[model samples]
Target: MTRNIAMKILLSFLILVAVSACASRQVALVPEDKPFSARKNAEIALLYWIDSLPHVLTTGVDNLIPSPARAAAFQSALEALLRDDPGLAATAAETAGYQVVIFNFGDIRFLALADSRHPGIGPTVIVNPNARRELIAGAPHPVFEEGVDIEAGLFVTRLEARAAIIAGAHACASSVASRCATADNVCPGNGSAPVRVSDAAHNTVLLYQLAHETLAHAWPDSIVFSLRGMMRADNAIVIFSDGSRRHAGVEALPNRLRDGVAATSLSSAGKIVSCQDADDDTLARRSFCGAGNVQGRFLNGSPDACSVDASASSGRFVHLEQGGIVLARLRSAAQLNLSGSAAENLLRGIAAVIPSSEMPMASPDSASGPGQDRR
Candidate 1:
């Protein structure tokens, strides 16, 4: 009996030693946590802002600014992004109520700022501060940043960020690996104010920031129009399943026929065009579809059907009038490009030019109903 007891004690000792050694290895691999700073917070916020800008802008174009001028416009936008970097950081930090640390990952040349405010929230979880972090973290990579070359720069940045997060993740019990040290009960790092907590958060934030910057550079025209359209429309982008989206109240249409169905509700295709009912049955007669189909009449379901012609330009501007005054004028404007702010302005101008006598405010009943569209 004594021999059995002695053997058991020896086995327990060996197990303890093995566990200790494993923990030591883990701690040795991770970086020591340090103080967080304003720069880091700014970096995190910037990345998030950049990453999310594309979707936001895409959704609100037409009613916002209009079409953008590529050459001169893109440069101006890049400058603006750099200018706003600091403000973004301040906002993110204030929101978290904690300091942050940042690191430039060597591979992608991307930046990762650690938000260590709550070590309990998983180490280094990347954040799109303006949006939900949980959603951002798991989102597809391309959704955030653009022009990520496989060879260098931002690619390296992403790698280093991941490594750092992995290093510091032990701070939270949920992220703490079994191999973590007992002495610390967390990652082997000082929970310094503004210090980056781990890789996950850092990576996610950087991804978002890069995405924003990239989109800003790629689609300046879209940005201006989206904002401008929102201001004019006073409505939000309504998502649809056919991979096509709509920003109503910004663009004028005649009827609501979608996907061969009445535009009385959400649709997958072919609906009637609709608008704020004014007097111009022409503007109220047609609808734009995801497949580039435009059809319908600007009739108020009256015995007298009014035939009208409307045209959609590249930048998503649709011009329609009593006898095509807006469409004819816009079509003749050789300088007008529908893909930029100018196009948005043209759309706005078209809306403004039509005398109230011609345009009609749509009845609330004519509007698309909710959930009429299937994903």
Candidate 2:
């Protein structure tokens, strides 16, 4: 076990080195859906943070919702549980040169849903008792001295990624469903099953069902759009080489959950989540566009009812890390809000919780991309 842990640490170190080099490129950035400015890009690397254990679906994607038992399970899972199956698709994507890495912040932040109200969502910051009194003073949402975690971060923003994932899942389902048209057990591998969205699971589960269909493919490679800051679900910490590219997906969908406390298991290390655009068709483009095509959608599905104040709408994470919004922070911000005010006070508070600081930190002026500093 010791050796295994050591190897895991070593592997993480190597990845850190590679990702760091990529971040320093200072090359022209490309949109997530668009081709990389440079073609030799052998690998499409995706890095994200997750805070919880993803809910495990028992009766396939088709049945997770219609069955009241399943919904209860889903809601129950809203809090606890973690499994490692998404890696299967990640490996398959690697076949096509897609690299996906995840850092589990679950150790520092656990899975918790937003209050569904005006939740003060932002990067995890340490609030000095004094600072907390000043900024969060009259604010209903005070940065608690200790044991208070942001409930809605990347997890809630998943709605944006869901748009892309679902679109790809549909394409995958179409492909796999075609395989079983003539007979059962004809799909592929051990689980060549058909997906029926009409099965009546919750929308989220239904989306997963569509995504899981790609698993039946010899190689399920779909696109994953990480658009949570628009939803203000994450601290907006840029943990990937293409931080600017990833942030482009902002404001893609209606604030999926405009108001909530979102510090999720979404960015947790070792666990990767994304719905890749498995097929290159119109649906895929539209989905990606909807997620974040040039700061907003190309196709307007319906007027976004969530944003009461367009300026005040989501993007709360962007606000928390606003100053460095253009460039990736890679390091955690201590700013009180989007203004990117100094985080010194917040750090004093953070010392109480993360005194040792497993999370990375960067100075205000030096805006480097994501890396845990592998060297």
Candidate 3:
């Protein structure tokens, strides 16, 4: 009687194992609709999977993760692309309920897990197993070791990556801060204000001085100026906020001005600037625009009513970076023993991009219209 009962229990265990194996082999069909195809109309979330914090100082493999500097560069470049393309709008990752999510693994490959909780969004493999194996082999320390099986390591890594993505999506969706801005003034502010000019580094001080000098000399009352101090191991940035780019009569001008601003800054700085139109090889080979470096973007072209604030109606977004033209110029000057005048010239070049004459006229009253107090 005891032997018969034991045999029956063993049979049940075997059946369970067989079912699990078959489920693992089954492939989930990708839906007919592409996830990011409607990105222009939908809110999308971006996730960067890096092991270290942005401020942590590390060497070699540690640099591969998306540090604060790298994240800022990628975000800036993406925003610029969306602004010029006229389709997608850039929303903060903190913004909730995004319809699509993009995971950037520092060029590493990852597989998407089947999400049973959301029907029809089953486990889909984003990267093929062969490709994933190759990436893992080349990946930095902690990803690959000498003795352990490579296949097992790859499987574990992929699972972890998928889990992180899902966790990030869930967190963003549930956070109260994720709601879209209802008014322009209520729009999210830049993460933090710039450091004091006196205590900042030489380059930072120079940029801060340039921002003020430009406002005072070039476009006083034309825009609100702010300095984005340098990121860790990154260059300083200056932001020129002209308010909402969307208004009743001149809806499209903000993007044009943004492009013009970037173009003028790049040309006048007298350095090679990278653009999305450049070939991948060219971008990869170039140090300034390469992975983990600064890349500028114009971010004020979204037409979605909920995506932007009332202040955005004034067309008030402009971002300037030291990574490309500015960084190159600074480096070259330091090597050549040149004076501080180079920084000044770069600032003036940026200032020249602002088209004060064509700026949208701001109403005198504070609470009058959408684009009021813009210029």
Question: lDDT of all the models against the reference?
Answer: 0.22, 0.20, 0.23
lDDT, residue 120, model 1: 24
* lDDT by residue for model 2 (1-375), tens: 133432333233212111121231112232334332221121111112211212222223332222444333322222111122223323332232222233222122111121111111111111111111101100111121110111112112211111111111111122213211211121225363542322211122332332222111211111122222111213332121111112223222111211111123222211111112122122112222122221111011113311111112122111111112322221211211312322222223212321121211112122321111111
Q: Could you give candidate 3's per-residue lDDT for residues 1-375 as a string of tens digits?
A: 133432332222211100111122321223333333322111011111121101111211111123354334323322322222111312221121111122222233222222122321111111121121111111111111111112112222422111111111111111123222322111124233221111111111111122222222222133322212122122223222223322233223223333444454343433322222222223212222211100001112234322333223233322222333233322221122213433344343433444222232112222332222332
Relative to the unseen true structure, what is the C-alpha lDDT of residue 99 in candidate 1, on a scale of 0 to 100? 26
Task: List TM-scores for all candidates, in order.
Answer: 0.17, 0.22, 0.23
Candidate 1, residues 1-375: lDDT per residue as tens digits?
133432332222211100110121111122233423423323332333223222221221121111233212322322222233423443343343322332222211222333333332222222221210001111111211121111011111221111111112221212212221112111234343221212221221222223322332232221101100111111111211111122333232312211112222222222223333232224232221211111111111111111112221222221111112112222211222223332233233322322122212112122332112111
RMSD of each: 25.8, 21.7, 25.3
- The TM-score measured for candidate 2 stands at 0.22
- Model 3 ranges off by over 4 Å: 1-221, 229-314, 324-340, 355-365, 369-375
Stronger candidate by lDDT (1 vs 2): 1
Best by TM-score: 3
Comparing 1 and 3 by lDDT, which wins?
3
